[model samples]
Target chain A: MLYFILRRILMLVPVVIGLTVIMFAIARILPGDPVALAAGPNATPAEIEALSHEFGLDQPIWTQYFHYVGGLLHGDLGTSLLTRRPVAADIAAYLPATLELVCAAMLIAVAIGIPLGLATAVWRNRWPDYLSQVVAIGAISMPRFFLGLLLQLCFAMWLMWLPLGGRLPIIVIPPPTVTGFLTIDTLLAGDLHAFTMALRHLAMPAIAMSLSPLATIMRMMRASTIEVMGQDYVMTARALGLPRGKIILKYVARNAVSATLTVIGLYFGWLLGGTVLVETVFDWPGLGLYATKAIVSQDMMPVIGVALVIGLLFVLANLVIDLLYGVINPKVRYS
Target chain B: MTGPLLSIRDLHLTMTSFDGAAHVLNGIDLTVQRGEIWGLVGESGCGKSLTGLSISRLVPTPPATYRKGEIRFEGRDILKLPLREMQDLRGKRIGMIFQDPTTNLNPAYRVGEQLIDVALAAASHDPSVLGCPPGAGRRERRRAARRLAGEMLERVGIPDAGARLDNYPHEFSGGMRQRVLIAMALIGRPDLLIADEPTTALDVSVQAQILKLLKGTVADHDIGVILITHNLGVVAETCSHVAVMYAGNIVESGPVSNVIESPAHPYTRALMAAIPTKASKRGTLKGLGGTVPNLITPPPGCRFAPRCPLAIPACTAALPGAVDLGADHRAACIRLEALEHV
Candidate 1:
């Protein structure tokens, strides 16, 4: 097991290198000059030339790539032209917000999706199954941004049950940062009021972000549950006279959930991308919002930094999933 | 306690699907006593496996329904038992092993974990026999069950049983997996066992070994077994009694020796003739002609009538009653007397 985990981590080296290459290439390929964008339009040609040389933009592409790689090794992500701060520092500030939102959305998706999937499978062709089918279809078919808008319209505007947008109400004093997650920070501070307010603000955006992944998880879980329930081992479990509930929980669900776990892990990586739209719509101060602002002002460093961070996060999520597989299935442990 | 381990009388099962209701088991009768291994021999789709599933009430409902039958296990009508009691009876009183060793044991769990689960379940049902104390704590009960599982695996001829307990089902070979399955089934100390083509997925050499293991286990446990198989040779070698099924009905059944030496029903005779022997030449092996009759809208009277060369008009008029042939042997055929001369 140790060997397996070590090997999986080692395999990430090439993947991280490839991600760096892509991030660098994407930043370089975009139209417009970073130096020109950084220097105001009123700046003279000589000033632009000095800024370009200072930024090392006058060097050949390969030289610039090598310089970037060297700086990356030293934890320098260059400076965001718009923010005038280190890109890594900018990412560090914004990332936790995105992480908090994504984690909450995932928690909501898994908490609801798995049970609904199992229920649908067990009560197949029944009302519960039919209801989930409608839910799954609606969740999968509707666009995330559209869903976000609809949720905001219903809960924030019409019902006034939730805050319209943003991570917290402007009137409330923000909790001191601990984990950079407002809910946890508030709880750590023993401020129940702040936590409650944060949760209320989190509800709509989280629900909107969760819907599609929840549908994917539910469909995968339902299909996997149905397939596993029909396995010969399940029949053997039935023949063993194991309690109906135990059979479903221990034998059927244990086997069925592996497939769903894979889908969840893959979706976790994709959900980071999903956050851009959701974060933009909700006006949440996160990496997605940062990336959106960077793109609008043509600030390439933060864009590259965000892409690298997301790529690294995607790899890390799958690694956790791979490790979890060994725990859930013995076959994977030996392999 | 005094009668046979299991008795099925006038058992009839029908499967209702979009097509129609198919009569899967037609007025079947079987009796299994302690220590008697009865082989139920038949071709595919002949209701042999279904009969075994019926005894355990493992057949899925909706698609399958018992039209009329009484399955008495230990003098109690299992058919009338409440769902909870029926669950207790299964795995504890009656254990079942199925075909396809590759799929029977869950791939995700260790072989021992699966075995321990059954042992725990059985102990819960009958605490006295499994040596688990009435008020044993969770850990103590688990340790006891694990020990029992290890012992059962060893009993089924798995070498290094203690170490092998941690190995998953996929790690074991086909025959080893089947042996593991047998261990799991017998872990409960069940009074009866239903082995539905338990060795069918194994190699020819592995098949004999599995059969031997099964026979030895049955003898040691003194448990009745219903060995469902398509191979007549296996039945002759391992079983004390044999029942030959065609379509949904048992055409002939008796003492294994009596049935093998002098099969009375034409279907049984045809099955025997199909077996390749030292005397039978190459290409001379007589395969039974015609497909098994569809159970849905099955031909009236004798199900094998269409395939029987000596079939008469009387055979199609009504289902023949079992005619006694002495020595506890019987065959369901009207021309028993005429066939006696042949």
Candidate 2:
């Protein structure tokens, strides 16, 4: 096990580097000029040239890439053109909100999806199963932006229940120091008003973000549950006069969950990709919307930065999943 | 001839699909006496496992429908019992050991946990296990669960059952897993244990060990065992009674010694001839020379008539009924008179 853990950790370096390289290349190849964007459209050519020289954009792409990669080895992520701040600073600023939202959404999804999936499998060809199928299908078919808008319309505008978007109300912007995330910082101060504001604002966006992945996970879990039910152990469990609930829990779900993990990993990576739409629709400022802003403004550094961050996340998420195989199922090892 | 602990009478199972209705098990009647091992020997698709599953009320309803039958255990019709009652009877009164040791035990669970699950499921009804009325205390239940796991593991010859109970299924070898399964089934001390091709998944060496374990386990207890296998040698070694099924019908059945020494049905003879024993020497050996008739539009008469060398005119296009050969031995064949006359 120690051997496996050490080997897995070692192997992660090249994979992370590969993802960073691909993301960096893709961001660079895409048509854009960061220096011109920074200098502004009305700026004189001399000013744009000066800005380009300042940011080292005058160097050849290869030289720039080598410099960027070399800087990355020493923990540099360049600077955001808009903020005139380090790109890593912007990520440090934004990451926690994404983490909280994504984590909360995944928790909501799996907590609901797994049991509902199992329930659907249990009541297969019945009303409950059909109902789950309908709900999942609806979630899958509908656009995330549409769902986000609908949620905002219903919950925020019509009912005036939830805050439509943003981390907190502007009136009580908690000082972000230890935790860069406004929501966490607000709660750390034991500020109930601020926490409630953060939570209310989080509702619509998180649910909107969660729906499609929830549907995907539900479908996978249901299929896997059905497949596991057909296995010999389930029959053995049944033949023992094992209770329906016990059999489902021990024999069916136990085996199915392992297969479901791969699906969950794939969906998780997809969720990172899908979150961009949710963030844009809800006007929730996170890595997704952050990337879009960078793209539109032609801020190539932040674009590369956002792409690298997300690409790293995708790589790490998959690595975390692969590592989980050993924990969930002892039969498999990294080796 | 003590009365059977379980009796499967006139068992008929049919599977209806888009193609047609396939009659899988046709009138499979057999008796399993207490403490006796009956080998249901036939190649794949013979419905031996189906017959075993029927006893526990585990057969799938729609596709694998019981066209007609009575599976009696402890003088009660299993098919007639409520699902709740049947669930109570399973694992406790009747347990099943399935084929494929790899898939038979859940991979995600620890051996001890699964054993305890079976034990507690069986013991939940017993006042002795709970040490009180229903809804036992948490601490007591936990203690009982552990003790039950230990006792079961000890019974199955797993060393350090207490410490090793937390170990997952893959940690154990194939033979060990089979032993664990046997322990799980026997934890309830069931009256009838159905072993469906128990040794088929194990290697040659492990097969012997498992068979030996099963024989010893059965001998120690008075439980009846139904050993389902296609291997004649295994049947000869372990079972007291042997029932030969062909295309879902039991064509021949009698005392194991009697069946092996002298098989009544031609299919049984063909199967016997097919297996290369010490008698059938040289590279050239006899074979039945035909596959089983398609169950969907199964031949109007004997399913094995097309393959039987001694098949008479009466054997074709005509259903054969039971021919009593005395001493509880029975065979479904038309040429019984010819054999008796000889």
- Candidate 1 accuracy as lDDT: 0.89
Q: Worst lDDT window (10 residues) for model 2 chain B?
A: B125-134
**Model 1 Cα shift for residue B45 (angstroms):** 0.9
- Residue range A279-299, candidate 1, lDDT tens digits: 888988999999998888887
lDDT of 1 by residue, B126-160 (tens): 88656877999989988998888888889889999
> Largest DockQ belongs to which candidate?
2
RMSD of 2: 2.7
Residue-wise C-alpha lDDT for candidate 2, range B1-342, written one tens digit per residue: 356699889988998899999899988888888878999999899888888888888888888788788988877889999998898889888888988888888888788778878877887645464344467786677678778778778777888878878988888888888888998888777889999999998898889878888888789988899999989999999988999999989999989888888788777877887887787679878776888789998877888888876777878767798788876678999986676554
For model 2, how big is the iRMS in angstroms? Answer: 1.0
Candidate 2 deviant stretches above 4 angstroms: A1-33, A175-178, A181-183, A333-335, B1-3, B127-136, B279-281, B316-318, B340-342
Q: After superposition, how far is residue B259 of candidate 1 from its true place, in Å?
A: 0.4
TM-score of the candidate numbered 2?
Answer: 0.93
DockQ of 2: 0.79
How close is each model in CA RMSD to the real structure? 2.3, 2.7
